[model samples]
Target: MTSVSEGRIHGGAVPLITRGPLRTTLRAGDGVRIEAVYEPCTAGAAAADGAAGAGTAIVLAHGFTGSADRPAVRRAAEVFAQRAAVVTFSFRGHGGSGGRSTVGDREVLDLAAAVAWARSLGHRRIVTAGFSMGGSVVLRHGALYTAPGVREEGGGRTEAHGEAHADAVVSVSAPARWFYRGTAPMRRLHWMVTRPTGRLVGRYGFRTRIDRRPWDPVPLSPVEAAGRIAPAPLLIVHGDRDPYFPLDHPRTLAEAAGGAAELWLEPGMGHAENAADESLLTRISDWATAR
Candidate 1:
């Protein structure tokens, strides 16, 4: 069950705002505590300004090492809030959330909790937008939650029935497959995830706690998940210059969807939330609303 509490917005990276966002602690189905924030829509096109999206809500899943309070995550929330209410949360092991990071393996439960909360708040439409590691998560979450009879790898039934299903999904700068060491950035990330000393760096330098255990049964790949998110709108956005995953990642995802998804190959954009400019964000917001 998820509980609400008044949360203050602070930290040097966060910009001063006239209104404070609603903060709460979300308990995932597995009982991990997730830190989340809800920002009301400020756009003029909506029926009521600051009415919490009126009818729509966008849930944001940040990349590895990112938190709801990060400047980049807040910036994306601010932009999306122009079109709909926004939900942003820190994955387990990041920010003030509990539990160690399972990388992308068990993070699906965190996203599910956030989406269910958004639905409970009376939003008719819920869209999920994820970046980097988060990008892969949203895809898998959409597949596991929206599709019936889809199970986890080890004969475990995914809790597919719930309000956790997203009406639409957006993935930015996510990898197609796991254990990709082709790029230098990806190699460094693997080191941070696999090595003991590297986990220390993740904890101290990045404020992210890495889980030391390996996946007992690997989860679905992003490409495979994309194929199952049909009948629901899916948007895959990737940068040509993304140092993490190349253009091929988005391409494979688009192809896997069997023409059911939209693919955008951005020019000169780097990676994740930090690289998402206002113009691009505005376009993404427009796309979500138009669907």
Candidate 2:
């Protein structure tokens, strides 16, 4: 992985390697092709290795305009795989995946597909970690699919029957409320440039483009979906100095969760700035695996 500014790691250059010799692939409802790097954990292996109880599985999703090959995704994948099974895939219109971006409205379906795929592989316990837009996708998925559903072509069945399908959700730098007026100054500037730019790009048939559709024109907003995820174990991580969605976004989400959620505010951290914080990541992983 190449090192970028703000200690961010970019995994686009590196190829994904799975534990076993074989690999897995899935197709979304929209015919978007998706790939997953899987690591199998047999009952015997779990018995031999005391750390494999319950067959914990983690699905990592990248942010807007990012693919599964991003550094943050790779890092989280490696960390979670050591403890349990790990599957990371690209969102539609990004990386090797297909289809246009839906600003996370439809991407939640993609995440649900990923979770089902992991469960099909015999993962009894599942957790999803998403960064930026990916974070929003996981939250939306938790809100939308409160009950178990039939697995997609290559996906697995939902783990729970009702209100128990998703065990836990972790969102990093996710904007809880999309169209709030209390945005920070830098974010306001971004909106100023992105809104007009999105409309202009839409005129040229680039509206569904990953970058333009989500940020520029404000695609699917997550704030409206926050209330739907209450009573679920939600983790909202944000930097106190975040210039993107503003720290208030997470704070509001935590309050909305009504004591069912936890918020971790990194002092002086900026947007996606905690990519290199291994301790924080481990803490989140532990929370995901804990009963």
Candidate 3:
């Protein structure tokens, strides 16, 4: 990390400020290289453009098989950039990043890196918004990084440092529990990550690399994680027509939060980033700003 004036830091070789967009690679706590991009808030952005928040940086987490360069992720980033600075990154084994994807297991470290990078860029307030698999990550990341006295088995985790925590979290189309195969899309997704032949399809068809190893101790579920995210505001958004996880997923998460989270069920919406439209993004931006 490169230190700059006023106590700001730059991850890898990325400078404090750049002429246009800032694109660079960040090293996670576990030494995985994550590909990330930083886009400053645009001038003269209107509320319709989702420009209600300022001086806040949103660390955008993409869903499984999604990357910073993906069309859906890029569109979301573009809309959020109008309101606040936006940081988008690819988890390990996705896009140009290093290592294999542990699904959402080790991806929390990737999000931690991005959040820390957002702080280093001088954003005092950080909001994390994720979709689908990324939504599960934001929930777990918020719980691990923000809740006081929380400790994991790994000694080198980023939670103790406090720099990776998000001031606000938005989970869109996330699941409450783990290892759920109720829906066909989820079952196919499971096969894609767990089976050798399906992993090939993930690589060639989706351009995502999957790690064959299962979770050693199985991390906290999204519902359990949601319970810990108090003080920090949480917004749970789910589509009524989501094919992956049913409405029960978001309901469980909101219930687990014990009224600390706000749940929004979008009518006719499907799943993840591809399903998140402009109006919903506008409302999300407004919510983050209010926090």
Q: In candidate 2, what are the lDDT values of residues 18-129, reduced to their tens digit?
A: 3462345666544456665665433335633556434677788787666666676777766665556677887766666766565566676567667766665556667878
Candidate maximizing TM-score = 3
Give the range of the ten consecutive residues with the poorest summed lDDT in model 2: 1-10
User: Candidate 1 lDDT, tens digit per residue, 23-84?
Assistant: 88887767788998988677644435434345788999999999999999999999999888
* lDDT of model 3 at position 143: 78
Per-residue accuracy of model 3 over 14-92 as CA lDDT, tens digit each: 4553336888888876777899999887644463255456568889999999999999999999888767789999998
User: 2 or 3, which is superior by lDDT?
Assistant: 3
Predictions ranked by lDDT, top down? 3, 1, 2
Strongest candidate by lDDT: 3
**Candidate 3: clashing pairs of residues:** none
Question: What TM-score do all the candidates reach, one by one?
Answer: 0.88, 0.73, 0.89
